[model samples]
Target: MDDIMRAIFACIPGMRSPASPGGCLSAAFGGGDDDGEEGEGEGEDRISRLPDAVLSSIVSRLPVKDGARTAVLSPRWRRVWASTPLVLDDADLLPDDDGPQIFWRDVADAVSRVLAAHPGPFRCVRLTNACSYAGSRGAAALSRWLGVLAAKGVQELVLVFLHAWPVRVEPPADVLRVSSLRRLYLGLWRSFPDTEHLRPGADVFPNLVELGICRTDIKAKDLDRLLQCSPALETLAFVVSYNTQPNVRVRSRSLRCVLFWMSIAEELAVVVAPRLERLILWNGCPCTRRVRRDFRTRVKIGYTPELKVLGYLEPRIHVLEIANTVIEAGTKPSPGTMVPTVKVLAMKVRFGVRQEAKMLLSFLRCFPNVETLHIMSAEADEPTGKLNFKLKFWQDVAPVECLKAHIKKVVFKNFRGERSELAFLRFVLERAQILQTLVVVLTDGDGDHASQEELGNRLKPLIYSTHRASKCAEFFIFVRCGGTSWSFRTASDLSRSDPFDC
Candidate 1:
């Protein structure tokens, strides 16, 4: 306290240092009439004079400790802190260099105290400390804090347990009881409560609008129940849970976006989602330490008429089904096979492989209304039959209707400038009559400076052929090192419209 006061005093030349930190803060924010002229008549503790509502708003935005510390400023501010809706984040309570080492137990205790102190109506709270409630005592601690939150009516809550994997300690079913929650994210939990057999009018997550479950052990039935309970849920995300293999059936009328990332799941069936717009699937690859689970996740699209954004659909990995028909490489594109509602589409294709190229064609044919297209050029390991399936394939295939009419933008990722890749670029440049922008994200060639110049010259020839498909098209080139680390916020953000626009 003395040191903090001394530091504040050191900043001012003639001002005497306060003996206590509280006095220093009082002088800073709770200044009297004498201090008003010190800073050119602008030092009249204007913050302290603010209306209680305005002051409470300011305090609510601060970290838990910082907001609570404002109490020492004045009785008015103290009252403000007490009255304002609590916004706590456990990450903000970490130990400083001068402070004593803070263990998880200490943080948990502090969080409990903070939750208890603030009377009611928690606006947003994120608890991400690696707190291992070891035994019965820890279990009791968890229940006590969760009980506080449930009683207080927390609106938005994100609880990420950073404990050791595989030992997912189940938090009490009090989680489902927080009917006040409008948004909830639970990471590394065992399971969500099964409220399937609840009484006639029993409320289960009645107010939850956005629910995110990550690395949790969830069953298909429980997932269904969660959906059934959360009638207002507009967005649902299941991310990277190797322990659970859920054949997710989307049966919610309110769900607009579903993000499935790095999860070892069997299938995702949009059976009854009328409002669903985006179905984003990232990696099916295995996690770093775990034994590789089979990556195929059959995607079935049924009753989703409002669906607009689709994919990162790997040609080899995902088995696409539309209107109860499984989309195959040889399946002819017809009215029954198409999803006419999809506008923005993304696909992972190995243009070098003949089968995948054909599959890519089939997938494109299925989405006839696609306006903006993103093609991720996947690297081929072993040839899936004939190699370097060139421009002839693109020229000979049944005309891709979207290319000639609907497509306004196309982003080709990992553009290695191979014969097949260049041929496709030539194909698009020649065919997409309405194309507005073309982006080529290269795979960062190993060529030297001179070789790079030669490659550039080659690309220019493709960019400027005797073709006049789109007269006003702009072009750009970028290098893709690996990629950005995926997150729920980035993937499920409907605002991004095009994930590959970057």
Candidate 2:
């Protein structure tokens, strides 16, 4: 071990002399045996024998303070912490009991010290719960920190302030110009820095691929400028952004995936982006129920020929207007109008028992080619007696092509065996000719063993009596127990788990 340590230390870039006390190899495994010469010991320093790259990786994964402590282990490792790309989070160093002011000061000082001590490139720097008490100084400190990181060619940067009051940090100009950055996530900022001086055709964030801005006060024009500057941007997410414009237009050909969550906009116009494949929108806001009023916000998907997955869509916002034509419930699309090329559709249903089946059927009719369907209950379960699902509900409705030819999987969460729920299940089972798997997850109230057994017995006759279109289709039921729920993956989901007995 001593000989191996000596050999490893000799290869390090700026290692101290072997006899020095600061030498990590000597400190880790004693200086030498009684022989007084360097290499004579049976002691094992197994970790030191690994390659330097591996050791650096292991140290990088540790908390910043823990990683910095490696400096005291041995001289060979003294520079390891300083050279490896840093991943710093302010919350890790802040004490829970410290006053907000003191917390801000401590975090600022710690970040400054780490950045000044570490040399060269940085992989990531995440600062969470920051700037709550630093006021103007906090903003300046953050700007300076970001400037230093930008100079160091950092790759990924995340700055999150979860305070109720508006964040005062002014985004550093260096952030907009960093060429090495590939991903950037900034949350809870009051606003974005102005980029009016940037040239029209010049590239900003030349290598940036993914960008997420949550709960920020960025304006519509400023966002458009940012998107225009990033030619390589592919995936973009705007969650709870305060864009007060009547329409937020995102036009990008390189983008493939877009996620809009809890944002306040009257309309989302996807004007260009021929390569877009996935579009996800969730209007549910955690802060207040008033934000639910934004559910009326409409979406305009245009020229996205490659769109394959459209999901988490609220029923109120299901009316999508493609190229000036509306696709809404009770209205069939005109000929030559491009339907969404979506294959997987996930949506929430909250209509009353009398309208549940009707609303679901209307929504499904919009996506004729969707093969996998995921349904989540948008409201509390309805009483069994209130549900009214009759065979006449499907009598007047025309057949949906996907149900007979393409739909192979269905997942229903928050299931209660109400009359309408059972009727809907039976209707799908009897109609979906190519169905392969059906997953029904019962609600927490119905999780008891007795309730589960009774529900299963009630559903058994329906399953046996119905003439299923797919002879090989199987049904699965998942029940919650002690707060956690068990899951069974089907063959279609690439699993070989045994089928549930229920």
Report the number of the highest-lDDT candidate.
1
Clashes (backbone N, CA, C under 3 Å), per candidate, total: 0, 3
Name the best candidate (by TM-score): 1
What lDDT does the true structure give each of the candidates?
0.71, 0.64
lDDT (tens digit, per residue) of candidate 1 on 296-400: 678999998899999889876789998889999878888889999889998988887787888888898899878999888878876566554453577776778
Candidate 2, which ten residues in sequence have the lowest lDDT sum?
A: 487-496
lDDT of 1: 0.71
Query: Which residue pairs collide, candidate 1?
Result: none
- On residues 449-468, what C-alpha lDDT tens digit does candidate 2 reach at each position? 88766666767777678778
Cα displacement (angstroms), candidate 2, residue 235, comes to 1.6
| After superposition, candidate 1 runs with Cα above 4 Å error | 1-46, 49-54, 98-101, 134-138, 196-202, 284-294, 444-455, 471-487
TM-score for every candidate vs. truth?
A: 0.84, 0.81
RMSD value for candidate 1: 8.5
